[model samples]
Target chain A: MMRSDDLVMLYSGPDQVDYAYLSPETAGVYQNKHGSFQHRSLVGKAFGTRIRASNSDGWVDALAPTPELWASAVRHRTQIVHQLDAAVVCFELGVRRSSVCAEAGTGSGAMTGALSRSCGSVHTYEFNEARATAAQGEFERNGLTNVTVRHCDVCEEGFRDLDVDSVDAVFLDLPEPWRALPHALRVAKPGARIATYSPCVEQVHRTRDALSTCLDLRTLEVRQRDFVVKDVLLETGLAPPAKRRKDYQNEDDAPRRYANCAFLAWF
Target chain B: MVDAGDEVVLWTSQGTYLFAEAKVGSTFRWTKRERVRVDALIGAPFGATFEIRGGALVRAAPRGAATTVEDDGERRDNRWLADDNRAQRLDADDLKRMRRDGASGEAIIDALVAGSDTFAHKTQFAQQKWLRRKQNKYLPWVRVLEPRAATIAAAYFSRGNLLPHRVVLRPDTVAQLVARANARDGAKIITVDHSGGVALAAILERIEPSGKALVPHRGPFEALRRCNLTDLDRRVVCFSLDETPPPQGDSLVLVAKTDPIANLDALLPLLCPSAPIVVYSDTVEPLAAAYAHLQASGLATAILLSETWLRDFQVLPNRTHPTMSMSATGGYLLSATKIVVADAA
Candidate 1:
């Protein structure tokens, strides 16, 4: 197990965008759109094998891998996890360093990057033989001995491990996570945390229903909105209040005001 | 910062004077010729007059470069301050000269900030830093004003039309380029690309794939095109701004400028009072300022500036204008029966 300073997972838009803030000095992990992480830096930064989440979409892009472990793992393809979702999951779940985790439907090794960075070990499952093979290579390249990819459908081949009730976290990004809820319940400890990502509401409902028996799911959804801000002059003498009031009350609650709403959000 | 609807005159060292409403809560700079633009004849301790017009500025006939010609008589250097005249008395001639001297509205703001500083040294340093930074950041934007204006005009004229002449992008963005595009008849949809030109090309490809994606390469001929785009069964014509003058036939519609402030300024002369000028923006400040200016200037009887533009200041709106519509939140249309007739004709 690799022990490092505060493990950071920063969310960037996608790909190793050249103009991003991740250039060296700033070391952590960058997630691609396909949910894969890659270790990147300005030539003078980083040590050991570069670990990145692998995906079918060429989501992982690492410059030069110095470590033998990273070179080997570079060939794998798995569904990598996005930095945003990963950070949210890690924080909300209160994951501890060196904790054992379970992940299902490893598309490209994105979530694996997160688990590998924060936990002691991860047992990831992938049904696709080709994907599993790719993931295996990535594990070797990153020199990650802790994360082991098993080539079996988590739903069918029940988890067989040294300990059943000691897993720290469980994450599912499959098409239908509800199907894996039963399997998740069987393997999870009493209060182990679980997280899932689904685009559609129908799937959210199904997963919520399926996990209801085993997990006491408190939080439901995460929504993000990006907006543009405009400054409006507050008519006349209200300048003092407008300038002093840092936190604005909703216009419905105010008499004199200036306002505009411009933003788009995604769930 | 000056509020919207506040009438102010700007002077410059250029021949033409400018009389423009503040479009944003911007500050002025202490660069060369800025004094003529903002402070007017105020700091000319030697006493001087100035004029303003069309946002440009110039100094009026000068009495003398030196007031009290005592070489060592401790004459207060007027060059370090504004002349005695206030912002209200600035006229068109001063604005014209200021424009000729390349003065900007931003200069007026820098002057105000400089004037507020308690320490003279600190004020000079701050103004200098601001001018340097602003020059570096806004040069690219100022250079493309012409083309940007044309693109906005085209989009504005195409409002309520189909997806061919008009296209929606970033349905998720506050500007709602897609929402407005979808709502308009004949509106076409396009995805956002990292490069602005690439995004425009993607739209053109969907409308006409005949190697016309090289429209920019088509030179002056780019504006004149045999358009065959249709949406919701309405006929549409697609052309680039550099190539096409405003559609000069009867019943034709024209888009003005992508820059919201300039766009409104152009529309003020063309639009009729009581006509709805729907405005939208990814941020509300520029649009609000424009709306307030239009209303206060007696240009429009009623103006509707949407509350949508105040989204995020970071994501600069594409400044796309929809035709035949006051911008819907600054991206909507500025409508008037006579204006439409005039533009179409």
Candidate 2:
């Protein structure tokens, strides 16, 4: 494991200037990754040409994706998971700050960031070399010494390196969560919570079917739900709306301010 | 005070102050002889009116004197009219005062209207002002607000699941609900949270249909936010509790888990024992659902939706047409223990 002080070298600071390297050729593959990874931010100017100091204030991630694991995923530019899902997983999945967790398909390292925040350590797997390198750099940048981002793909590589039957939680946000289900079932402690973030219904259905063979899969879908908090006028005749409309147009037209629903499923 | 042919301020139960011109006539006629009735009036200029009743000073009007009325049928017709006049006078005074105080007329109007005592008045004034401002500030002398269906829909969808959180009603809808609640003679108005309770207070501000004002019961909104609230989940927990909690009678509950004004909910519950309610909070997971959910849990119920649901949620173009989402709204008439999902949509 890299030292915590070594992780601070990714930022552009006085000491880590030599290590603050940006390879454009490496950035080629990740140019188009979209799940909230390509948005422009006003806070990106701090990413200078050197390793800078690291701080973990809530505001660090307020504007930009400051969660080190998420940033590692972003650095690789793979299809990263969203923050909401990560927060839900960390807070609701009963994953404590001391638990050991395993995450498959470290595509963008989002789950890795989330797992690192709660558990004592996280063993995450990713296949792409360039993505792994970027993620490693991000991990070092954010001073995350707990997460071990492996270069091998979980399907073929498996969890041979880690202890058997040890992890507390398994979070799968991959394309084929079922492919990793056997690996998860084999290693996931009994009654351990497994959360998967799949967009399409087919993915959810397939994952559920696979998990049911051994696990008491409780299928749950989480959508981004918004609460409209407007001032209630008593004297004037304003109360709850006469109806509750459940459907929404698309995210682009509305821009997610008025309402947001995150369709999610848990196993 | 009962002198015949006296010029007096005939302060009625309503908050209207009519400059009654006095004459030797019947009660109705003589009541108009410069006779000021402090009934049905929204804002009367301080010491503005002098009344003549039966040729004597029957009653006197004081400056900045606030009065209450019994909201009976006699002074009803003039309520709206008197309110309008009072508003107009306020408007006129506001305009002059602004000029005297070296402020812009528009600024004065904005301040006064913004400070309006009621949401209805504020909305009405703002709608006009905003429209005029848009016309003046923008080009083409025209501003067309596209039907914000997409935005409303997005907002609705953003709430993830509506199972356990509190929904804020626009002011007008609350008023209408309060009026309906007032009309209910023996029943209590149940709400989801302290905000709703405040809404109830606003509703019962004038004409509490019930003999006294409708007290509010408070609940939690924090639960709504933190907990993944679902309809089935709400039913499972609230009904399964061994202790049959006290029934909420005719009260409003404004549900906010982290509201600084939790005391508001506390005050209302103490004032009206039966009016306790639950608010769906993002932080506090109150053990109640929307009013409809409560009704389904087998408690006799009346569910009030905020009127602005249409505009705020983008269900209808305006507050006129029936659009989507009303299935959970309107007061529900149901037996306690029988949960029925009414067609609010």
Candidate 3:
């Protein structure tokens, strides 16, 4: 049975999936393309079971939330890091189980969730108060106890709350990552890995310059290309004339492909 | 050469000396006419110019050139060399005597310039080119480099034959693969390496001794053996392909060599949900097939990537571009996270 306050993915179809935190007290109705449902009634139901909406003939499945699901369903209060880039960042930072990691500008808590899942503890700082509070709420609702969200500007004040040279890895996803590099160096232990993500080359250059003295730096841009599968009818020479014509006309159609580029620096 | 016992390439006017040792007091029979002593190079930094016994001077050639000239935003004018027609006045015997007299490379170059009848009429670009050509030939130098994976790969690739045993994995690509695999301390990793253990070396470097690496091989790993990783050997266990132990859950698996798809399938049941699996191949076709298979299985989120590294020579402050020659392709990497999908409704 699904528990109260659990984040669930309400799946109607590929195009109309919704994520909602189950609540027992609030008499709220959640509506989607399928139908409307009382949020209170979703509790105590088994996940992956279809439930009929009270107002319409449509039905929806309440699915459990995975990291990938949460990534796609999370609220985009800020520009969220793509899942591919997040995975690469987590890997480059060497975020392992029981490892201590620090992150700056926890926008949308996208990568924060990944870090919390992979590491022992994550110290994430967000400059905006509202985003930090919202991320904190999300973390609590998702039962992510290993993460600590702080509403402080890490660049101006540095990571003073944490002990010096204590973290195992540091990840920066800020506008001015170069400005926060000194603090990252201060918090990270000797031989600890640091990774920074920026959208432009100029930012990477600045960040690289800032870290050149203390760390062995390597910069790369990771690109992810996704391919989808689709069935194509073979046009055999012995095929029927009409079927052969149809197959020839459909040759131009292909599945959609997605590619995204992310610039990264690690040491 | 800067370090003792390091392998270096000593370039001279006749030809290049391959695999020369950088030992103090060692004498190199540079050419039939010249003999060079290593004592003059022991303490000198790589790329430093020194005068030898002969009138010829040699500069230590670093693996890569250092930035010295600043870009003054001047464009090359090809038409400026149209009217330049001059002949050289300095003979070979004079240069050889000058080298035997222990004249500096700069002094020899100055003499060569003084002897060139057309040196005054040549354009600045042509003059610089001529000076550089002379410096490369007459100013003999040795570039000393530490033997890492990159240098080893480069040496093998430049042999004019692409052998499968020689892993052409670049240093950057190795770093990317390790990172993509999420290798870490205490993690159990399974690898199938045939590129003389280059991949294994990289994995061992990242995971250290805390993690255990299982390499399935029919024979000894020559590349890894050359690395002298005796202390870390305890962490690496070798097994036959058909009789390897089953992997525990939540372990990283890296497949670099033959039959990646088969290896991945055999290891699939052992991986925990969301465990990262990285497969590398020299070509994309195999990885593309692997990607399709993984996608069809409905248990993976596979992403395909190909990394091409471009090194740039920052010649001048304002004139920076990619080096003239570069490796066209390093390799293709396919990274996927294993997932347990619920039964379809």
Query: Would you list the rank order by DockQ, best first?
Result: 3, 1, 2
Model 2 regions lying over 4 Å from their true place: A1-76, A225-265, B1-258, B261-345
For every candidate in turn, the CA RMSD to the true structure comes to 27.4, 29.8, 8.5
Per-model TM-score, in order, reads: 0.29, 0.34, 0.60
Residue A8 of model 2 has an lDDT of: 19
Every candidate's fraction of true contacts kept comes to: 0.00, 0.00, 0.02
Q: How close is candidate 3 at the interface, in terms of C-alpha RMSD after superposing the true interface residues?
A: 7.7
For model 1 chain A, the run of ten residues with the poorest summed lDDT: A258-267
DockQ, all candidates in order? 0.02, 0.01, 0.10
lDDT of 3 by residue, B127-194 (tens): 65577677666565544333333333333344425555554565445655665675655667777776
For residue B127, model 2's alpha carbon misses the true position, in angstroms, by 59
Which prediction has the highest TM-score against the true structure?
3
Poorest lDDT segment (10 consecutive residues) of candidate 3 chain B: B60-69
lDDT of 1 by residue, B1-345 (tens): 223432232322221222323234332332454422333322222113333433323345531111111133333323555544542333557556655687765674454444443223233334344454433332211100111112322322333243333323221121222111111112232121222231332233222222122111222222122111224122223433354343221111112224556655543333221122333343445655665565456433213332222111111122212222223333333221111111110
Q: What would you estimate as the lDDT of candidate 3?
A: 0.64
Per residue, candidate 2 scores C-alpha lDDT tens digits across A150-215 of: 887776657657766788788876778778778877787754667776766567666766765432
